[model samples]
Target: MSTKTPFKAIIIGGGPVGLTFAQCFSAAGLDFTLLERRETVTPEEGAGIAISPTTFRIYDQLGLLDAINKIATPIPQKHVMTKDGHRYNSYEFHLRECHGRPMAFVHRHELLTMLHSTLSDDAKSKIQTNKSIASIVSTDHGVEVTCDDGSVISGSIVIGADGVHSKTRRLMNDLSGHEEPVFETTFQGMFGNFPRAANVEEGSQMEPGHDWEVHSDKISSQCFVGRERGWFIIYRPLAPGPTRERKTYTEEDVQAFAKDLIEMDLHLTDKVKFADVFKVVNKAGMTQLQEGAVLKRSFQRIVLAGDACNKITPNVGLGYNNGVVDVVYLTNALKKLVEDAGQTEIRTETIEELFARYQEDRRALSETVDSAARRVIRTVTHSDFVKYVLDRWVNPVLGLDKVYGTKVMGPLLAKQQVLEWLGEKNYLPGKIPWVHRGLVAGEVKA
Candidate 1:
């Protein structure tokens, strides 16, 4: 990589993480392109995303925070309730302190539109829709990508931002002769608007908090407020059943799922009927978050980011935030490398050093997130004893002092500093650690 190198980087995906990476690359004066299989940016029916403060910070950095605020609903609280009209645990947070802004809920489509609108004409031109990448070939000089259309594009570096089923990952596996990826579990999710029944409104008006409701019958319902949509999430154990066996759901099945959900909530059962509400069903096939290294170390010019690399459970709502931070750290690291290369000599050795830094910095954080997310998912989806403790003991205690308070991030942020240091050889850009990086870096052991 040289100042006059005119490096061409291809990002294979146009989702939030890929788009954000494109923005950062463009801002850094790099020649980059993004590819997406989807041709349009619009809200998919029945889907919602919870925007955490860390994610808000990334949007703010990209100058889209206000736009997000305009379209999203600020959720200051989460409520947990029981199936039979009893409250379990409630957690409330003031998002301003957690990530220097408030958390919000937005429709998935609206968010895509906001991000897509921010792309420059050059960046937009670089995005090719409906062009799915079929394979990636890394040569001595550059990386060549083959798309479904049989067209080939080559670049100095290739990034696989292509979601969980990444073609780039497959290519890397082929290059390395690794075992086939194994998926551990499948998740089903549905999103739909419920008519604001009087009871629903009353439930919404209750003290602001993250709510979890557990029923004696071994089911749980979690509800969160979105800007214009009220979101209801139900998680049940995946068992062998006719409902679980169906690969795709019919309209009637979706309607029935909604009816059953509403009926399960004693608070809303009498207030609304399945036929009275509008809803949409969204489902994702089982996906594996890749584990272990595909190569001996991070490749010199190739790397994976976001879902392309790891898939954590949505229980923590950190997927988007963590992905955004990946871009942030990668961009800053590359910027530093660029500046250093301009001042001194650049070599393959220097590039390798940077890649090592990336792997060192990101791997542990990724593993930590993976571990924490799985723990939460197991707690929520398995073990009746754990759920009982949460419903019976944790809920009451949380309600008394706002268990999910704005201060929730203090400990998390502190831990993140340690992880970032392990990955980046320094603390996150803005934070000041009690110990110097030089002292801690040695302790981190690369």
Candidate 2:
């Protein structure tokens, strides 16, 4: 089959998930144009990304595994410690052994740069930088995206890979005549960075091969160590603020926040407390993290993915991974129309059914992941008695790979019609396969 798209896919956002969508579409023989608000594909946003075995499959499909591995670190153990620097619980990072892949950690920028680089020349040509979308209109058989620059581009499908504050979603809600948007809740989190963690001895002094965390009474903190740079994340329960509110922080506010947390009793290494590590912090911020999936994922020709539809708390790094899988699911759905249209033609009447199926296929998974991330925040940040139970038996028993975590990725891919049609045999082999279905690369059907 010729690798070319018959009907164009207009992708909004040039972040990792949007770029991943372009790769999938290009590989699937679909044509697309990507519009990004940033000046370049590699945006300096986010940090301490956690990649699961499932995500590796997505990378393999996108043809960028070798490039990704260069800047990535496999997390072999998840070290749990006390503020006094005593190791209380250390669990073997056995996903690599059990699922054929280790949970990898990389700086957000490194992963995004590699993802953006993976695009073929043809795919690269589709990208338009600094083209921030101002509004979107759903037409009879297509959607028109208006940019802040007053230019409008129309396509058969419009996808939103924008972050939680998604303009596409808002436009979609307005065009549908719905007074309220689908999203509702958000959480508060504090994050800091440690540039010198790469110099610390692994296992003996700081942590194992991955990130580590030490909990304080009101604040819980975690740090991810990569090859060159590392990140510190602090999740603080909010004091009952209104949901879905946007927030901005001054550098002083972020510094003061980190100082207050560091001033508390949290330890990582003998030479460096987590506080000492924050003194020369490179980047940090406080944001109201959204935690709801849009009530509906698709509105006529416009569809949403990633944080645009579902933004969860980042306790276990669920949001970005889900965003990658979303590309697969959307690709599978779009491929059906492409295959049916004999490549380029689509039936307007069938359009609703096609997008509705995509929503049905993804909504449950989004809700599940959103619930699980929230559950983790509750579990790890519980009161004294609850934390004691979790620290002692509950967490150690459950381990790192939660029920819907990595253990389910391989099968998830098996369910996608695209990968299954392609007969991708390289997916991480799951123990119990999906009988009639399979992995969304895993977060998918099996």
Alpha-carbon lDDT, every model = 0.57, 0.70
Worst 10 residues of 1 by lDDT: 284-293
Regions more than 4 Å wrong, model 1 = 1-4, 41-45, 94-100, 193-218, 240-256, 259-300, 343-352, 398-409, 412-446
Q: Write the per-residue lDDT of candidate 2 for residues 1-446, one digit (tens) a residue.
A: 33333588889998878988887888788888899998998867656688876677667655567887888878766777666666667766655665567788887877778877777777888899999999887765677888999999888788999888888888888888766644444346777555655444444334436667765455666777666666777776666743555667677877777676667746654335666666656777787766777767777888889988888888867688888778887787777667777854465556777778878887656766777777766655654677657664666667644444445533443343334334344665544343332334445332
> What is the TM-score of each predicted model, taking all chains together?
0.77, 0.87
Best by lDDT: 2
Cα miss at 162, model 1 (Å)?
A: 1.0
In Å, residue 163's CA in model 2 sits off its true spot by 1.2
**Distance (Å) between predicted and true CA of 63, model 2?**
2.0
Estimate the TM-score for candidate 1: 0.77
What are the RMSD figures for all models against the true structure? 6.6, 4.6
User: Native-vs-model 1 lDDT?
Assistant: 0.57
For residue 207, give model 1's deviation from the true position in Å.
10
